[model samples]
Target: MNPAPDPELALEVLTDLVRTDLEACNRLIVERMQSPVALIPQLAAHLVAAGGKRIRPLLTLAAARLCGHRGQRHVALAACVEFIHTATLLHDDVVDESALRRGAPSANAVFGNKPSVLVGDFLFARAFQIMVADGSLRVLDILATASATIAEGEVLQLVTQNDTATTEEQYLQVIEGKTAALFAAATEVGAVVAERPQAEAEAMREYGHCLGVAFQLVDDALDYSASQAALGKTVGDDFREGKITLPVLLAFATADETERGFWRRVLEERDQSESDLDRAIGLMQARGTLQATITRAREYGARALEALSIFPDGAERRALAGIVEFCIARAR
Candidate 1:
């Protein structure tokens, strides 16, 4: 049998395959982030320099190449995707009151909430400028709708926070809106720039949607199980913030009254003690909820892989398939 796919290795391979385009995209991101107001660029640069996997923008570059795009339009569109993602991260840090992002102080922590929020708005406006410059109404519509959907998702998650009665379906809706919508838009716009047919664009959209769901599920599981270095943020952030994730929902579904009291006290009342996170993790482990969450992520990963079948056999397809492995393998 083939050796298990290594997610880091897979990511490196994808990065190498698109190294040139990725460089161009990075340059575009830097160019577009500059402004007359130094703080706008300074604060934005802090977050941008912190660096992420750039997975969403990578999807745009890879999907366009997979659809036979040879022009430079994908570079601009990829930059637009990154701007949108960065803007969201800036806003998220403020709203979540998160101290860290990607193993460093978050923009809000360094620049204060006011600067972070305004800079995030600046990035969003810059993204719109790029979209209009591209002159594709379809691209604009896809990204615009995604931005709105992401907001709706964040609001839905806010509504469900600290609510132990949050259903699995409700949790899925939250992720699909907040996370999957942008992933879908990122990939779909690739086909749009390439001028591919609607069916192909839909396939890419499906792939990204499934991948995004799997990505978030794995992230939620890692919050309780992974090391601080692996997680790139506080391990118990969700638990501390009373964010309802899949693992919590699964564990809560099988809890007795005594255990329910523990959850209510910690998650609902936010009356957490020092040992509460450990106890919460222990409950999830004994109940196998963490593993169950990973299993669910793998199911979505499978669907993401299936979505790529319509594309012919090639390195781009393989790299995209490996990305699915990369997202799910984080749970391992």
Candidate 2:
């Protein structure tokens, strides 16, 4: 049997690779963002310097190396993918009116919405330029499709805001579009660049899809369950923003009709209060919905791991396989 996956092996494989491309990404971002007006460069650089996981591009590089690719272009492409993701985040924070990310003020909050949104558009344009320079029509196609899906997912979440009736299916679609599609695309492009067989390429794509889903599910779960110190944001940020995340969805189902009055007030009524959050948390815990939410995330994690068995055993493959647990249990 294959050996058990290394828990931190993903982090290990990512260490040097992420560092190298992060430097390149930083350079490229600065080079492309320069303008006659200095504010553009200044604001964009501030957020880029703010720091993030940069996991999107790291996934690309790791996936490519795992599939036996040796070309230097993968590094450039990975950085390009990260820029696209970062751009989206700048835009997202503005749209969500979120104040904090990774324990700091968001780009929109600091630079104001106009600069954040405009800079985001500039990044998107720069990403496309870099992607096309690869001269791979297939790469452009996948990235295009994934980008459109991301837009749709964001709109879906916006439309579904505070709608307690948001179904699991709807939630899945939103997550797939908004978060997982990019992950799937980034990893899939790695396999595609390596000229892996169609089946294996498809396997990597599915692995990314499932892994992205699990990652977002756990992120949503953490919003309700983790403390600000641990999560780097307040619990119930979802509720405050009228987001009906997985834990909230479960709580809606499991809460008694009487107790659900509290949910309705917090999620539905315009007059939501601080006490409403306390009551909702208590009711959700009492009904075990928070645990159920974690269980739901675990099931996705299992599926993500299942998709990885297709690749042959190696440190890279093992690390890829182990990432599911990290994504699912990241709250701890």
Candidate 3:
């Protein structure tokens, strides 16, 4: 029998399968990101040229192909999805005061925060222009709502940050808004523009949403997993930033009085010593909270696979399922 699918190979295959369409999308992204004001394009290019897996736009392209779309609109729409995602990244780095992204200096670090924010705004406007050009009101509505939801997610994250009292449900809500909303929009719009049935569109949305949640869950777990080089960020970013992630939440839930007080001091009080992150990892491991977080991520991965059951068996479906595996495997 064939061995279990290699998650990395699956993603590489998916990238190759949609390469032609991805090239078209890239061209459109380049065209749209250009501005008469030199600084706008320069700052935007700083982030856009950074290497990434380009998963969001790939989802759009793959979903359109999965739905058997015969038009060229998917290319532009995929670029639009990318613009939204990139804009969010710029804004996020500024808010998080992040220095690195995709293993390189973040746009906000290279360009000032003001320029990063303004360029992010430009990307948002460009995304809307592409959507309007597509002339699909349903697509517009879906992506527009996702933009607002992302903002809400960011705000919710801000409120929950440094608050050890944040619940798992609340944390899920934040990720659903910030990350999964765009994923849902990217895939759902592919179906929408393909003129697929509403039920199929909804299924695509659910698939993307579940996949995105699993993706974020793994990211959160990895923050404390001592694999920051693979993650392309500092190992203790979430901890230092006092973002209450799943592992921390689970750890706090089961901590003894002393450990509970420790969490409160480090996270709630934002008072961390140099050794705090090492201690945090030790606590999470001893308590199996990191493993538990991975288990939770796998649960979402399973749901993501389930959502794709509505689609017929095909390479696209298999690759999509493989993405779920890849997300969970990252934490392992």
Candidate closest to the true structure, highest lDDT: 1
RMSD of each: 1.4, 2.1, 1.5
Candidate with the greatest TM-score versus the true structure: 1
Query: Which of the two candidates, 1 or 3, achieves a greater TM-score against the reference?
Result: 1
Better of 2 and 3 by TM-score: 3
lDDT of 1 by residue, 286-327 (tens): 999999999999999999888889988888888889898989
> How much does candidate 1 score in TM-score?
0.98
Model 3: how far residue 304 lies from native, Å: 1.0
Model 2 C-alpha lDDT per residue in residues 38-130, reported as the tens digit of each score: 887887777667776667777787788788887866776776788778788988988888888777788788889998898888878878998
Steric clashes per prediction: 0, 0, 0
Q: Candidate 3 lDDT, tens digit per residue, 242-272?
A: 9998999999999999999999999999899
Candidate 3 regions off by >4 Å?
Answer: 1-4
Model 1 deviation from native, Cα RMSD in Å: 1.4
Which candidate, 1 or 3, would have the higher lDDT against the true structure?
1
Q: Residue 32 of model 3: what lDDT?
A: 86
Would you list the clashing residue pairs of candidate 3?
none
